[model samples]
Target: MLEVSAAREIVLRHAKRLKADFTALMSSSLGQVIAADVASDVDSPPFDKSLMDGYAVRAADVSPTAELTVVEEIPAGKMPTKTVGPGEAVRLFTGAPIPPGADAVVMREKTDSPSADRVVIREVPTAGQFILRQATEMKVGETVIPAGTVLTPATFGLLASVGKTTVPAYPQPKVAVVATGDELVEPNRRPKPGQIRNSNGPMLTAQVALAGGLPRYIGIATDREDVLRSYIAEGLEIANVLILAGGVSAGDFDLVPKVLKDCGVTAHFHHVKMKPGKPLLFGTKGDKLVFGLPGNPVSSFVGFELFVKPALRVMGGHIDPPTATQKLTLSEPFAANNNRPTYHPAKRDGDGVRGLKWFGSPDLRAMLDADAFLVLPPGEVNYAAGAVVEVLPINRTAS
Candidate 1:
């Protein structure tokens, strides 16, 4: 079996980024990756503006006990009509343009207008205080957002500030999730004796959506070769990426790998040296990619995170497709079963990681309290408390 890192390298080597397309800037654009660098058409703050609603004054003319003439009042979004001279001040609100000849601003709280057009400077003012200089925040034609950047709320605001109504971005991939097993039934129906409701189908669909891919839950495929072949062919025709849960292990009823080969998918790797998801399969045919995950819920989940998630991210034009990993101290002692690397579900406790109660690969409930997985490599066992370990965050990128 291939090591975890080798498997990941193979998947990334086969996965290629999709073509860029123009998309309108809307709420739905969130989480989409940019295809090109976005440059600002104009400078932010556009002109010399006010940072606060205060008096714009010539700093040299203001003293501890000097009273200045209020020459003009400037509100936000309006240009200043008069400039400040010696012993003069301008009443300005926030975001208003700084008037000419004004080097600083004295806040209203620091100055008192004892009479109309007359103001008393209670505090001495410094030059260029409370004023935002033009082009200081962003220069004209500066690159505001770079390529491969994910569009978040703050990024959307930045794009809007630069008048980017239509953005060029890589389109999200359409994923088809197919679960194969004769013992599997729909979630709405109770399973008969020796049968189980299909959890991998819904779980895989949700996982695809969370990774910014559009998911379609193709119905479950029975163990029969004909039925599995039909579903696999249909998935390939409709979706850019296909995910098949179960039927990849070395068993008589496990027939997904064979069916995928019959449908012309060249196998990349069939097994990895990792617990819970060792029977992971990755393949490609033409422009589409396929993942044959293990039947166990935890195995399927881990396979998607370790292999498929990065592929989806790469297709969306992310420069760094792999989810980030962190090194954290283990709060308690733990051990591994075999020589293969093990991913133990864990939670953050204070500043360290605490392993949760994990029964096996099929125990999906144990994952509810897990925010990350403590990765234990081969031949390493008998970890003591406070041992530093590498952690891969679950369901989100590590910070």
Candidate 2:
């Protein structure tokens, strides 16, 4: 059996970044990677602009106190009709263009308009105060967002500022989720004895989307080799990653590994020494990845977070995605499995992490309020409250 780190490393070795680029609307590119550097088409602020609603005047005209002639009023989006000379000012609102010959802006609260054509200044003004100069933020043809940058709301805003309606970005990988087993039935149908609802398919689809991949759900595949082959062939043809839940453990019905090999997928690793995810299988063919996850819902859940998410990051153009782990004290005592490292479903308390009431691998109810998983290393250990432990947070924000 491979160690967790070793298995993960092997998975990443096969995760090649897709080099092709496609044009997509800026609004749809959030949380995606840019394929090429994007340059600004126009200078930011293009002209001298005002940062406040005030009088634009010569600095010497408002040294502590002065009364000045109000030449014109410049509202936002309206050009100034008059230039301010000595003892003169232009009334300007926020975001209005700074008029010619105006060097400073004194806030309206600091000055009073005694008459329609005249104004009084009560505060001194300095040169360039409240003035946004042309090209100060960005120049035309400058690189606004570099290549391989992960798109965020702020980045999209920046691109919009440069008049970019579309951007060259890498497409999110399309993942196919397939559930296996003749013992499985869709949630819409009531299951007979010795049968179970196919929860892994929907759960894995959600996981794929959360990791920034587009998920396509393929219905359950039965245990027969012919049925498995048909589903596997369809998945491989349509998606960049094919994820089949179950039929991976050593059993008479364990037909996924053999069928996948026949379909040209080279298996990288078959087992990992981790609780709940021991029978995780990873393979590749051409540019696509295939994962055969254990049938247990919690095992499938843990397997995706530990093995698949990192591969998605690399394929999405991240050089080094951070592991979302933190150290916290345990809020309650826990007695975990000692044969292998286990990740117990946990919730964040006010000042610590607390494990939930759980039964080994098959207990999906334990994950109801779980926001993280507490990592328990292999040992015959009884941890008391307040014992420091590491946890991996789920549903991390995209930045």
Candidate 3:
């Protein structure tokens, strides 16, 4: 059995970053990694401005008994006519440029005679108040964001603030999916006797997209060795990775292993000891990466979350993909052998996580409602309630 860390090394070692491409805008490049460091061309806010709507006066001009004449009014878009001097002041609004020689701003609330013509100071004003200095937000020639950073919505706004209209980001990976099974039916069609719907293909495709990859749905394949081989070959020709669902188990009718072996592919490992996806298989055929997931729906979900997400991250130019793990108390008790690690879909309630009722790998409905998976490590005794367990977030919202 392949350990989880060993499998991760094998998968990430083969990860190859896609070529850099130009994106229309920063928002369009969400989850894409930056290829180079981005620097601000000019200092943000460019000039000193006022942060409040008040009267800009010279420090000496403001006094408890002095009166000043308003020479000019400066709005946001206009500039001041002359520098402020003794016995002179300017009316300023928010975001307006602070006129030269004006050392302080007196709030309108502190002045008397609410007319706009002239005002008498009822209170002494502090120096250099309400002025936002230039380059306070960002400096010129400084790296705003380093390479390999994921472009989120906040990052996109920051990029725009630095006058970046277009950006160069790592290209999104393209994945081709191949679902193998003879008894599989389409989702829209009702399944007859002894037939099940082919959901792994669409499910895996959606997972690929959710992980920031471009999914190329290649449809279903028959159980025949020749048919599976042809589909695998086609998928390999077009996509960076080939994800083949089903046909890796010990069943005599499972022809995926035979077809891969016939194609001169080197099978890295055939099975893992993890629950819900023990029959997972990973290998390499020439320069193409391949993964054969279990037939069950929940098994496929688990396999993709653990095995495929990291590879997709590296291939998208991220040095290391992000993973969310937390320690949470179990709400109920459960029993299992310590030989193999177990991952059960769980829901977070209050301060603990509760294991949902599931029917093993075939239960997709139960898995859909789960926010995370409670990971029970190998070689443990009975897990009683209130025991702390490591939780790995499966749903993207939590992550």
Candidate 4:
């Protein structure tokens, strides 16, 4: 029975950052953490340009009822050809380069086109009007996107604006799921007496993929030391994380601890003082993370959210891990007191969270309609209605 803080500390101390490579284009880099700071190679909008489709002219030439001769027309993408001289103007389009010696631009709507060669200005335009200065968006050699920034679509557009084609990011972590149970058969296979088709395997596999990790299904292992050790050894060779299911409890046939001990794996914490997932095990074999979850389907899912998701983020070089803890009012009273911290699958309705009624750990039926969990800490009589309590969302939007 370990405190929550103590358990977190143990997991952090025992965890190791993953060693892998990842590089992709900025468009494909969404949700990935940047490994290096993104610097602008050149000034954004590189040169002084016009921000409006108008006439580029010297500010001195602009006056009420003054007429200036149009010397040249400049469109976007091509450089300006003529310099704006006294009593001279250039027709410019949006994004066109400002011609030399031009200090202001008058909107076309403001000026009357008396003739094709000459234009009369009814309004006086001020200096620097409709001009976008160079390097206004970003400066050259300045860091635009810093390291550890989780790239989104907006960030990707920013990177592209700064002329970054490819991006450097930490590779997605490779997770190997080892579901150890003698009574568990494969999901596609039919189950016999005293056998249950493995639900944790497919569930955890999908969970890993959702967490931005590559999931490798290593199949099930019998509750025997030799078979479990062989599977673990194989997992250690290629996976950054080895997730073991159904062999962490203090049951007679739990062989995960013995196998890890024999393989010289370091155990951070064997048990956490949390209901539905008390027997969670966090360990490491060199740089690989080893997470052992309980046998129950519901407990396995909860353990992945509580432990494995954050661990994967840290290993993937993300500065901030996924978090879902938020304060919400409880719609019903909770009965689990001081014995352990309880995380009951719940649904959020309006402004409050309602914990569902179900048989404790092994019950997976209540979770189908559950959106999150109404978390209750130790040493509490009950959470009365209208009390603010922390809730951890288990839905996809939480991360």
Top of the candidates by TM-score: 1
Q: Mind giving the per-residue lDDT tens digits that candidate 3 earns over 331-390? A: 888656546787888998789888888878899999777988888777765778998988
Per-residue alpha-carbon lDDT of candidate 4 for residues 192-229, written as tens digits (9 for 90 to 100): 99999888888899888778778899999998899999
TM-score ranking of the models:
1, 2, 3, 4
Question: In model 1, what is the error at residue 234, expressed in angstroms?
Answer: 1.8
Ranked by TM-score, the better of candidates 2 and 3 is 2
TM-scores for every candidate against the unseen true structure? 0.96, 0.94, 0.92, 0.86
* Candidate 2 lDDT by residue in tens digits, 37-145: 9898898888899999999999966766699999999999998877789889999998899999999998999998889889999988889999999999999999989
Candidate 4 clashing pairs, residues 3+ apart or interchain: 338-379
Model 3's alpha-carbon lDDT is: 0.82
Q: Model 4 misses residue 320 by how many Å? A: 1.6
RMSD of 3: 2.3
From the highest lDDT down, the ranking of the candidates is 1, 2, 4, 3
What local lDDT score does residue 20 receive in model 3, on the 0 to 100 scale? 89
Off by over 4 Å in 2: 320-324, 396-399
Q: Pairs clashing in candidate 3?
A: none
Determine the backbone clash count of candidate 3.
Answer: 0
Output the TM-score of candidate 4. 0.86
The TM-score between candidate 1 and the true structure equals: 0.96
The 0-to-1 C-alpha lDDT of every candidate, in the order given, reads 0.89, 0.88, 0.82, 0.83
